[model samples]
Target: MSETTNVMNSEVVKRLLCYVSYDTQSKDESSEVPSTQKQFDLAKVLKKELEEIGASDVRLSDHCYVYAKIPSNLDKKVPAIGFIAHMDTSPALSGKDIKPQIIQNYDGGVIKLGESGFSMGPNEFPALAELKGKSLITTDGTTLLGADDKAGVAEIMTMAAFFLAHPEVKHGDICIAFTPDEEVGNGVEYFDVPGFGADFAYTVDGGSVGEIEYENFNAANLRVEVQGYGIHPGSAKGKMKNAIRMAMEFEQMLTVFDNPEYTDGYEGFHHLGGIEGDSDHTTMHYIVRDHDAGKLNQKLAEIDKASEYLNFKYGEGSFKVVRTGSYQNMKEMILPHMHLVEYAKEAMRELGLNAKSVPIRGGTDGARLSFMGLPCPNLCTGGANYHGRFEYACIEQMELCVEILKKIVEKYAVKEI
Candidate 1:
């Protein structure tokens, strides 16, 4: 790459630093689409920037979605594509006043985060060792870096601006969206898929630098309730049916060893994320996950059976489990049109990166959109440790991300049979 034509331009990096400053963490407990108004604060700014960059139909919707259409120049027929990234950060940690640590030419050892004991240690995260020679952007140990999707946003914005300035590139209509509440699972809830028309889309929200996911967990949120009859322990012996005890027992019936801490890599797990209980009433919250739909359904059934077994032992209606739909694997939506994945992979390879396809242990807006008649697969933003305090991203890898999006546009803009 020549000096003038090289990727990883300084303007993109500066824009990334500017984006990470916004605190847009979404609340899962909140019922609203954006979950927080702070997301809009960022969305408004992005819409203005998009307009300045010459994007057409740049609109920020009431639901806190920013959409822009980049027009095509070539006379040849090409499939319209969408590039998506989320604006909200994970609610797991604070995304406020993010202090990013920029490491230039990392040397493959323990790089302590700020003045704290937390570090990019090879002993702890061996993946850091793989990034020995790369430039890394990490948090300052006090707060999360919000790189989970912000890097994705920066990458998409950079590519969009690049294409707008260089109309000679001759790309097709490129649909770009920056969504809110992605961390809270409401990214595509109010999204107008038909409004922002595209043949397919790719979400820049996956981990690592080369991930391309079309499969994800068939998720279901579970709520278990236990009811017990209260009685005076001193006056009545064996009359006290403790609901808390029943609730604890209910949790015990499930395989505790199958927890997140004990699971990884395509292995399914039944995790109890939260629990609240007392002698008279008890409630437990869990999320069942599996890449295989059959296995996921089996886990949900097992949870119901566990509750039913307790109910049978204590009495009818003593304890019950309620299941609610969360998100489905996008593979069902993408399998029919697998070429989009191929396009993304070809783009990555053209930019000299690996084409690694993996199952998403979690969900994304793409997962929902894919089910909603859009074959969307997830792309990488060079981020890691998502939704956690230890979140970080490789700046050099983010540079690659921008280049990959450009190539995807280039590939589709001109195709020969």
Candidate 2:
């Protein structure tokens, strides 16, 4: 019933729809900063839109990062807060020519997607049960909805528009940015944290409403290579060692219960992402994740132990393990600034939203930015089932998120904490 809620509803939806229409899916294999050139499409649009909305210092970096500022209206200086979101969608699904389906007044039943034969109900997606009577936006089953962070982008843009429209609202310097390739984990690769000019910031790239995240998994990528002797099948008793089978053995050495499908809520996981090879040579790709840094190291040690045992059993140099650190949990960085979390919770509470601090099962740009310098936390964008065809967003929840953001800005404006 609040003025902000009413005003942001349509505008946020319009922005989201416009953003998803651009094919901004980032590629993981590319060496480019954005990983894909299409991300600039959305970046350009955001830059133009930000300038049009009266935001100052609007600049779209060559690397596809859009940065802008809303000058402080108050005479007294307060902490400059930044709001961030990503411009790229995940490469898991095709993001080209997306035709969004807008379901008005969702009735808590099985809603079918457009002609792609995909239907989701309360039974499958339990989150849908609580979303009845709300307006839902979904994909047509042919492509992803791009709501993972586009919803966040739209919410931030809408909030910026609100602040620019109401000068009397009185706020400190508001920093705004939309970075590229967040889906591929290079969102902050070219980000200039010092130049961003924020005492602290938030990445509005979370699921559902009222979810505030500061903790995320300590992540690493693992590659295991196996070399085996190949012989004719006619005489392959003890003379031949199959690399594919050895690779499977290396996988079995990992704890079965520690896999992604079996783990949840702070539990570490070793996910076997893919396997490629033949009898002579095999390669296994895995991602290791845990909330605790020590536990994450333990997981990597376990992989090393498995590799050593396999090498001992087979032959030296038969098993190889390569571990690469991805990103660490942001809890330590944000702990020194717990007020950021409290302010977000307080803002949501004032808007009748029950904010909950949840651990991010995956990483965000904020996770890296936190360690870089800014104590940034993650905020909800009213999205669900990210990076896939079943992705959707709740219109009412998104409007509430915009309001929550507005409230957070207002709090920072009046108080320094």
Candidate 3:
């Protein structure tokens, strides 16, 4: 199971460790856009790192969003491209004080996360077996590895630094943006596109190296509140409207086939991600997703009808429902601007890396940016099992990822001293 790519620079490991040492976990329940203050800590450091690498006008906004410009060294006018990565990690696990363990020579065996029983192994995650001779950075079972987007951040930083230091390599204007609230779907809420001034962009926030994506689920969030009538059990007869029972009935109205557990790969599903409350009142949170816009609306219609039907059955005002637009599929928006997609794939191929272009089962900042007229797609970071304790990344894969990213930019733009 030894499949290591030793072509990457060893210095990348050093930069990655420093980036992950900061705690940048997002809090979904928070009212703020960033959701966590620690996110800015990392954002500020990245801003400094970019400036230190010769990025001009490196600035951190009031909301902790970081932006910087790398002017083109070439005199010819060309397309300006942007590279983006989110600053916050998922709220799924603790990201504080991450202890990243470096396995210089992976043996394809089980990796102990911590304690006794729970460990990351090939038997559990066969993907680890693919990194036999490669270097691996993993968490110690207690905290999640921030490599999900941080690796993407560091990779972009590494590439940008390379371009700045080697001005002899021609390229166009390169823009870097680090957004917040990505974990909660509000990352690009306040993003200024005209200010960014880039023809096309890519979010370097995907799994596995060489991964490129131009599609994502058309998503919306559903909030259902079941309000049951209260009455003493002893005195209740036909008047007792239990919200819990009604909520169950409402759920039963939808097709179980339209669920996440029953779907995979381009197939969308309705996921009941949150639920709470008892007896007198309750709330249920659902996520409706579909690649097809028509079908996406159909799912929302189904939810509306389901709620209306329950209301009709249990009398008026039996329940309430709200659906918020989360993110959209960028494929349709990207059709007119197809060159960006080809440019990225070609960039990877030119770097001797096979680009795996696919659709995202979930949402990304790129999804939102596309609707905002940016038409952004997602690129890989060479990490895997994101947002969990067992998460790990191939150091060598990220190094190559940085190289491919630079080449992608070089294809469309030039920066020469």
Summed over model 1, clashes come to 0
Evaluation by lDDT, superior candidate among 1 and 3:
1
- Candidate 1 per-residue lDDT, tens place, 1-417, comes to 012223235666677788989889899778787899999989999999999999999999999999999987888778899999999998888999888887777888877788757766878788888998777778878788888789899999999999999887788999999999888778898998998878889998888877789888888888887888877778657777899888888888887766778877787788888888778788888889888888888888878889788888999989878774578878888988888888889888887788889988788889999888888899998888877667878877888889888888888887642
Q: Can you tell me which runs of candidate 1 are displaced by over 4 Å?
A: 1-9, 230-236
TM-score of each: 0.95, 0.96, 0.94
> What digit string (tens of lDDT, one per residue) describes model 2 on residues 1-417?
112344345999989989999999999757889898888888889999998999999998889999999999998989999999998989899999999988887889998888988888889899999999888889889999999889999999999999999999989999999999888879999998888899999999999899999999999987888999988889999799999999988899888999899989999999999899999999999999999999999999999999999999999999988874489999999999998999999999888888899999999999999999999999999999998989999999999999999998999988866
Top-lDDT candidate index: 2
CA lDDT, candidate 2, residue 200:
96
> How many backbone collisions does model 3 have?
6
What is the Å distance of residue 50 in model 1 from its true position?
Answer: 0.2
